[model samples]
Target chain A: MQPTSANFIANARDAIADDNLQLAIARVGENFGAKRQQAVDKLPEFDALCGRAVEIKDDVLAHLDYYLEVYERAVTASGGHVHWCATVEEACETVLRLCRSVDAKTVTKGKSMIGEEMEINPYLERHGIEPIETDLGEYIIQLAGEPPSHIIAPAVHKTKEQVTDLFHEHHRKFGKTERLTEGEDLVAEARELLRGKYLAADVGITGANFLIAETGSSIIVTNEGNGDLTQMLPKMHIVLASLEKVVPTLEDAATLLRLLARSASGQEMSSYTTLSTGPRRADDPDGPGEYHVVLLDNGRSELLGGEFQDILRCIRCGACYNHCPVYTSVGGHAYGWVYGGPMGAVLTPALIGLAEARHLPSATPFCGRCEEVCPMQIPLPKMMRHWREQSFQRRLTPGRERLAVALWAWFARRPALYHLGARFAIGWLFRRARGRGHMRKVPFMRGWTLTRDLPAPEGGTFQQQWRRRKRA
Target chain B: MSNKTQGGRATILGWIRGSLDRGELSAEQRAAIDSRLANPRRNLIPARAQVDHAAQVELFLEYLGAANGTFTRVAAEADAPKALSEYLSSQNLPQRVAMAPDAWLQGLPWEKGAPLLERRAGPARPEDQVGVTGALAGIAETGTLMLVSGPDSPSTLTMLPETHVVVLRASQIIGAMEDGWDALRKREGQGKMPRTAIFITGPSRTGDIEMHMYLGAHGPRRLHVIFIDES
Candidate 1:
């Protein structure tokens, strides 16, 4: 989980040239994007609900300390323990201690981005407790020994053939050697194999979509029922969540839930939206015995009241990922961290430091599709722009790029010089094109024109056209 | 709390307060936040869920079908076992079912109405093919069933089996998720909730492999709702 975001350009180049990744990204981009559009079109109140969701999150962020204290009190009153960890190491150590207390050998995990952020799997493995990802996507990637490619669909980058191969290799020890070609067979095989792990796991760990202060419950919205099975069968259940996930009440959570599924996968509702309050009640026939919540605040508190504070309102729906052109082109791993796409471009720098993830902000073309589709209305492109400005100010940008920008700024300050330079550059490019629509090679832009042609500029600048129109 | 945990708590809250550019909240500010939490406000409810009772029921059925969940309407609760039997036979599934030990479900005439059907009342086992439970309410907005776990209503019955059958009363159908929350508040009182409240819209599914959705992904493949109408 060490950040490779600084190598985003190299990673993106590899992703673009990857045939298998391209095939997978094509399907996800087309399918999830269209489905979200269809779901949004169905609900007349979708936008209104989005606005309300944003307001609710903003309210929580404004009174975050108060709400979190209230949330901690509620969890304690419900006989559940809440652990506050300011750093990922502390969070991982807390989980390890809990697992050790229970003498856990294996733990079942639902798909949790926060768990990925904490890198709890490897941490637990090193401490002698095995962690199993029960979600089919997370399972596939875990088998493949890779981080997730998408937030919701972890194995999205793996084609069916890749999954068949992964299963064939990993399931051989389980006495299953069949190379499953069909998606249904693959899913059934995983389901059959993981069902026992769920039963045997001593503890369950799931991420919270929303932590309700009203009921001290952690809500998980999943299409697969693995999360429920993970928590229900285990002796202990632990919820991993960032601090911003808390809401004032169940009613507030309901408003966000209304937009979650519709924006994420274009469903009216996910298959299962489970809210686990605390450990099993005394009279309960079946449930976990002990419940614990780990509230992680790794770098989130630093984002508050800053220009980047809006990113905390994100619900991790992956809507922005699906809608981002840059994300669709190169896919998630190109972003080089636990999160990817527009949100990651803005947030990775904040959490991991701008120096390590400076390239993420500059990876975008600033098309602004991410903000348009975001359920929380996080201004992703604007945040990315903020990161870019910070990068430049911090001298993280390349010296050559800085020089180019500085020169452009100098000219921009003098409008007459800028217009004259624009006229001269347009005339030279127009002649270089030889009436062709595009140029195959351009000086100092080999990276841009290598895979695609640069369109030839017209002979006149906008200023010339405007003055001509005015005179006519 | 351990000292380590207390340190973390103080550090995080301190940082949050510092970033928000404030000391501890004033009494007025605390009162405002406490009031907001005390009296939760309802936000926008979609027009789709705001309809007449008959229309809501119709919308629920429509959306349920759209979500790939099957349902059968019966005139009386006694007919539920018969309807469940018919559904199992139609789908060529086993006649055996693990039923939740809820008192309401136990009153159903499984033995009298469907003698051939084998039913065990308890939490669902891994080998169980079909599981039946009673739902707290059905949300008409998205065709979701709201179920709370308790001594009688085991959570496993809803997820462990390959096929899950729910017996919901038509009168228990609510307009939206907010209404469902309101009902839970009225039943459990404020700040008191069941251990788990699951809202199931359809059978378990996954689009993980090649983004091709497959049902019965580690949960029930078929979700059959048996609606009892005693009106």
Candidate 2:
């Protein structure tokens, strides 16, 4: 999971040129975007619910230490262990040690963003425990040997034909020879194969949508129910969650649950919303024998009470991802990280350094759709602007860009020189058009002119027009 | 716990406190948080789920159908076994099924009604074609069924089979998810919860393959609810 955010421009160019990626991105934009609108339209209290959700998450962040302690005490009371890890390396080692304790060879995994952040699969493989992704999108991407392109929809960049190829190539080892074309057959084949994996795996790992401090339970919302089986059939269940996921109570979790599925995939409810408190009781018929939670910091604790604290309220619904124009155009791989789209643009630089991910904040068109559609009311565009300011202050921006901005500022400080320069530039550009309304090329703006013609400057500057109007 | 884990916990909590510019919480703030956790308040409930008893039942049925789940309403609890058998025969599924061993489910006269069906009460095996269990509550807001795992109610009955049959009493219908949580809190008491509590809306599904949703991805393909009118 080494970031290619430094090479975002190249990756975006490649994504834009990929036909299959374009088709998949269009489906996300058209399908998920329209469905979200319809779901929102159906709920009259959607805005009110979103406001309340924001309040809940903000409250959690303000007193995160208290809530985490309450949550840990509750888990301990329920016979579960809580492991706190400040860094990804510590988190990975904790998981490996737990697996080793159970003498586990294979572990089934539900879709977990923290797992992606920790890069636990590769870490486990290096240590001899094999991790299997049971979620369909995650399984597809795992076989393709690629990181998830989308947070919710991991293999969203792959076409069905590509999936057919992936399953055809990988399922050969399982003695399946025929190539499946229909989506149903592909799902069936994977389900059949993974059923055994779920039974055989010694441990299960899942991410928590919310950890309730009232009851010390971790909740997962999913449609396919792979997570339910993963935790139920295994000997141990380990929940990987960041500190920000903890909520105060079950009622708070319910309020957020009302928004999660609709914002994520336009469903009234996901097929399965399971809350696991601890391992099986003595009188219980069947369940995991051991329960553990790995509470990760991984830079999230540093975001508290800062200008970027609102980003921690994100529920990972992918509504902002669906609504982002740049994300829809370039797909998620171009972001070159676990998270993608508007949220990723703001969060990547914070988790990783701004120097390594300077291009992400600058990649936005600032249409404000992401902010408008966010369920938690996070000001994504404003946070991206913050990142931009920090990058500029750090001089992480390219030298040429800094020089242009500095030169513009130098003239901007003198209004008279700025007006004179503007007038000269406009007149020269108008003449260069040679009576045409547009120019195919422009100096130092080739990026803008590459895709579409630049409109020739029409009329004088705003100040000139204002003076002339006053005189008349 | 290991020293490393304890140190990590202390360090993270310290960082959070430092970032917030506070070393310790005042007496009032701690008291407020304690009360909030003790008595969790219910937030806004949508108008769609706020209804009378009869209307709530109607809304639940409407949403269940909308979510692609099928159901049958019976006047008595004894009718569930017959209805389940009919459903299995109609769908061309196997006569044998894995059923949850809840007292209410076991008390039913499966021998008198649907005698041809061979039912085993336990956790579902990999080869089970159908699973039968009783639901804790039916949510009227989104046609969801709340199933909690316990000694009698195995969690696997809902997931391993291709088809799932849920028996619910009409009296158990709730107006919203908040109501369901309240019921669970009353049953399990404060600071206690079951190992697993699953709220299932419909059959398993996925849209990852080109965004074309296909049912029965890894869980039950069909979810059938039998509402018994205990009133």
Candidate 3:
């Protein structure tokens, strides 16, 4: 995956132009948001749960090095192999080597964002090994040859009708000619299609939501039973997860689970919450014969000792995405990477240098809704501001924005000049708009006016209004 | 591909030593791991005593009812056949049922010669009705069911159907979420959790697309709970 966070604002502006997608997104987002709010309100201990979750994550990160070692030891002791990769390419190569070791002809996959980050599907395909996405949303996107749009709902941007069309186009190549009109028909078709792949595949790939260091386990949650099938039926199972997913113990993981579902989808619990440690036991009747954990550092080591370290606490519950105003408007694909929404904004800059993802931090209207709803309570806007500062320092920001900031700072040093400059601009803009009272066109403000007109500065600046009120 | 190129790949020992030399982690930090591992036990918040099975069952029914799921109780596993027969008749459905062949179903006596109604397979279609074999370990504190799939039970029973009728044994019920986790860990082991361990409270539901609540949008529309008590 090439980083696309920089082009998000531009892509989002174009996405909003599609009336149907905009309508569906707005309607769906508002409903999930309200349901989540109601769910939180029903539980008196919701805030306490959030606090406990954050504390658990904080403790785990503080001792992450220890927990990671413990996790590695336990997993290896259980007859599983552990490989540490410092970057995305290393991780991908490790997985490929493992596949070659097993002579894997076909691979079945559960939803793993780390796999997306490594662009594993294409890599596996290039090696002449087939990789099938078992999750319904992921499978649909796979058929369309598009990246997943949402963390939870990978194909959230596509409508049911669109899915029906995609299935019609691809189903025939597999010798299936029937076209499904309803959602259920589509689901049934996908189930039959993926099951054959699952049974025939030599290896299974999945993502872990949390890595329990105490027990050396990889925890996964899913509503559909496909993930279980992927991990169990295949001869080999591989988990690709980031370095920061480790938690100290089962109890800490329990605390995080209490808030994960409620924050993500307002469910008391998801349909399936699974934790796998190594390969199957000697007494176990059914499971993969081999298990491997690929731990990807991918620039996270630098984040461990920095101000934006709180971002490492993220469990990818996607609460921040659901609550973001910008994400709700454009949906996930516009972020143009494996992760999207508020978490993506904070993470994209850190993973793929700030020089490339500069606009992601500025894309936010600074709404602060992401922080308010985050399960780990990651101070997202503050982290984004840190990214912005880095962008400014690196001279990555455009010349115009830099000049504007410099001029504003200069006038800001002289309070009288600042008030006069603001007052004059406001009066002139208001008069130019002529009672319409909004600037449809303005110099050096095309970014603001591109999507929506800016409301004329309300007759005067805040400083002037505040001084007049005080005198009165 | 060549021997020289193969040798170019760094060894694990080299990487470890390099990381150590980077000096990112402190010496005190490396020592702390040994101390923590030497003593693994930590203080735990003891879970509360379990509620009686009857009360636990009733609480689950009530919670499910609040979430708009239907409920029916049978005398035993044998009674499930008659119960399902009448239930199926009432819905005026054909002799097609998607069944997850778990241990629970093996224990149940299917209609003597009904030819095991068209076995629903693979992904659930909206038209399909699946009979899931449930090993329900209920959490009374939150009124939840912990379902695990194995040889006796297939994963398809809970999902891939229009209606789901889960048979819950009284003994399988536990008191709290933690207890259920502990029990599951003990059964499977510290490491191997099932691929899909669904803690379902009620039927499949969604409020998206519009605020109007819609049940059975993605998964099962009607969830019917069957309580079986051998005692």
DockQ (0 to 1) for model 3: 0.20
Supply the global lDDT for candidate 3. 0.72
lDDT string, candidate 2, B138-173, tens digits:
999999999999989999999999999999999999
Error of 1 at A367 (Å): 1.1
Residue-level lDDT tens digits of model 1 in A1-472:
9888888989999999999999999887899899999999999988888889988999899999999999999898888999999999999999999998999999999999999999999999999999999999999999888999898888899988898999999999999988899889999999999999999999999999999987799999999999999999999999999999999988888889988898899999999999999899999999999999999999999999999999999999999999888889999998889999889898899999999999988888888899999999998888888988998998988899999999999999999999999999999899999999999998988988989998998749998999898999
Better of 2 and 3 by DockQ: 2
In candidate 3, stretches whose alpha carbon ends up further than 4 angstroms from where it belongs are A430-436, A450-454, A457-460, B1-55, B63-71, B75-136, B141-143, B147-166, B184-225, B229-231
The two-chain DockQ for each candidate, comma-separated, is 0.89, 0.89, 0.20
Q: Decide which is better by TM-score, 1 or 3.
A: 1
Model 3, range A219-331, lDDT digits (tens) per residue? 88766656766787778999998878987666667677777777777765665577677776664545777999888778776676477889999988787888888888898
Native-structure RMSD, model 2 = 1.2
Predicted structure with the largest DockQ when compared to the true one:
1
Ranking by TM-score: 1, 2, 3
Kindly give the stretch of ten consecutive residues in candidate 2 chain A with the minimal lDDT sum.
Answer: A456-465
**Residue-wise lDDT of candidate 2 within A49-98, one digit each (tens)?**
99999999999999999989889999999999999999999999999999
Task: Score residue A460 of candidate 3 by CA lDDT.
Answer: 80
The root-mean-square deviation over C-alpha atoms between each candidate and the true structure, in angstroms, is 1.1, 1.2, 5.2
